[model samples]
Target: MDLDLAAVRAFVAVADDRYFGDAAAGLGISQQAVSKRVAKLEADLGTALLRRTPNGAEPTEDGASFLVQARALIALADQAVDLVRSRHRALRVGVLGTRIASAETVRAFHETVPDVGVEMLRSEGLADALTALARGTIDAFFGRALGDLGGIEARPVYLEPVHVLVGRGHPFAALDGVPIADLAGRSLWVPGAVRPETEWADFYRVLAAEFGVRVDTTGPNFGVDDLVERTAASPELITGVGEKIRVPWHRGVVQIPVVEPSPCYPWSLLWHPRNRHPVLPELVAFTREGFRPYRPGRDWIPEPDRPAFTA
Candidate 1:
C-alpha cells in the first residue's frame, strides 16, 4: 500500500500535540481534516494509531514505535526537497542589517563557487535570522549566536568591540575616545520591552551593569533615526553599538570607540545542519579554514578579563 506523506505529517503533528484540535491549529487546517488524514494513515497501515483520552489523544503501542519512523521519513522528505531545489543554482544568506560585515565572506564564497547565485536577506535580529534559516528562506546567516540554536550549526567568526555613539559636539565627543567607565552616570538609549524583536537588549543591559554604564530602558521602538535624534538633542544620553554598524552622518552624531574595558560582541555564522545545498558545505569550509578571530590592538584595554557577550 502507498503511504501518503501528507497523512504522515498530519499523524506526526497529532502525535506531537496529543490533540487533534491543537494539531489542526498548528497545521492551519480544520479539526475534521486532520482527523480524516490521520484516520486514512492508520487504515493504510492496518493499525489503530491513536486512542482518545479525557486530556487528549494518546498513541497506541504500534503508533509509539511508528512515530520514530514517521519523523525520520518527514526529515528525509524535507531533505529531498531541499536537494532538488538547490540544483536550480541559488543560495541566500541572511543578514541582520545593511551593514553585517559579510561583504568579504560573500565575495570569498562567490570566488570559491562562482556558479551559484548568492543573495542576501535582511532580518531584524538573531531570532528572526534563525527562523528564516529554518524555513529555508535563507541558507545561512551572520549574527551573534545565542545559547540555544536548536538544530542549526553556529561557527564563530570574530569578536567585535562595542562603540559609543554620542551626538557630535557633545562633551564626550571632544576627546579621541572615552573609557567604558566614563558612561557610568549617562543615559544610554536602548530599545526596551516595547521592541520585542530587538534581540540585543539583554546584552546591552548586562554590559551596563558590568561597566557601570547607565542605560535608559524607557523607549518605544526606536530606530536608527530615533537614536541619532535623541542623542543629538540630549548630550547626557548616549548608546552603545557594534563596531561595524554604519551610522549615517547626520552632522549630529559621532561614533566613538569605547576603550579601557571595551565590551566584546561575538559574531557567528549560522546554518541549518541538514541543508543540502551543494555550495553550503563549501562555503562553511571556506570560512572555517580561513576566517580570522578578532584580536585587540596594542592600545586596547582588556575587559578586566571579563567574559564575552553570548547574545
Candidate 2:
C-alpha cells in the first residue's frame, strides 16, 4: 500500500486520542499534517479510515481492521529488533573458497565476540557465488579478478593483480613476468574456450583482439587438473586463474606474474537487499576494513580493473 510509517504512526495516534488537535499534540505535529495523512491513507487504501461524528472521531469497521494490521506491523517491527538482540549468536555465511580470503581474521573477530555464530561454505567460482546469492543460500562470495561489479549492487572488499599459471618445467614458467605477447602464439588452455562467445567471454577477448594475439583454446575452463596436465605436456599451453589459487606443487606447476599492463581481479563481499542480519552490518563493516585495498584502494590495481562484471 501507499501507506508510510509516518502516516501509520499518525493514524495510530489519532485512533488512540480520537481528537485531531490532541493527537497532533501527542505526535508533535500539526493537526493539518495529521488530517492530510489520514486523507492520503484513505485515498491510498480506497477506504475511509476515520469518520467524523458528534463524539470526536471513531474508526470505521475497515479502519478498525487496518488498525489491527498497523499495530501488528509496529509490534512486529519491535519484535524484529528483539529477535536481533536475542538470537544473534547464530549467523550462517558462505565463502567462495576456503583459500579465497582473509578468512582467518573474519573467524577471529567472530570468535572474540562470542555472541555470533559464523558458518562458511565453498563455491565453484563467481557464477556459483551469484547463484547462491540469488537463492539466498549464502550471504557473501569472492571470485576471480575480471568484470565490472559497479551495477551489481555490491561493495568490493579486496583485489589482487591477475597471474598466469604454467607448469614449472615449461620454458616460460620461470620468468618473473611475461609480456602479453609471450602468450600470443601459445596453445592457450582457456576456460569456456570451446563455448560460443558470451558477452562475458567478449571481455576476456579484449587482450587477444587488441594485441593481435592468437590462442588455441579447447576444453572445459573450470578444471585445474586439466590445465596442469596440458602444461605438463605442452610448453605452449597455459591457463589463467585467480591469484588466490596458490601453486601447491612447485615441482610441476608454477604461477608467474603478468607484468606488462596486467589486470587485477577483485574479490567482493555482496549481500542481498533483504539480508538484514543482526551481526551482518557489523561484520560487513569489519570485512570491508579488513580487506581494504592498498594506498590507491580501487585505483591502485593494474589496467582494466574496469569493474566487476556480471552477466
Model number with the top TM-score: 1
User: Each candidate's root-mean-square deviation in Å?
Assistant: 6.8, 12.2
Clashing pairs in 2: 145-265, 147-307, 147-308, 147-309, 148-307, 148-308, 148-309, 149-307, 149-308, 191-221
The digit string of per-residue lDDT tens for model 2 on 1-311 reads 45577788788888999999999999899999999988887888889888888888889999999999999887787667755653454555666445434354456567766766777776555565666765656665444334543333466666555567776667777688877666666544556444433322443566567555554566556455656666766555676655665445545677776656554555556666666567767767776665644334222242454343221
Candidate 1 structure quality by residue, lDDT tens digits, 171-203: 888877778667787767665323534546656
Minimal lDDT window, size 10, model 1: 298-307
Give each model's whole-structure lDDT.
0.74, 0.63
Segments of candidate 2 deviating more than 4 angstroms: 1-90, 101-115, 124-135, 144-152, 192-203, 210-217, 290-311
Candidate 1: C-alpha RMSD to true structure equals: 6.8
Which pairs of residues collide in model 1?
none
Error of 1 at 95 (Å): 1.9
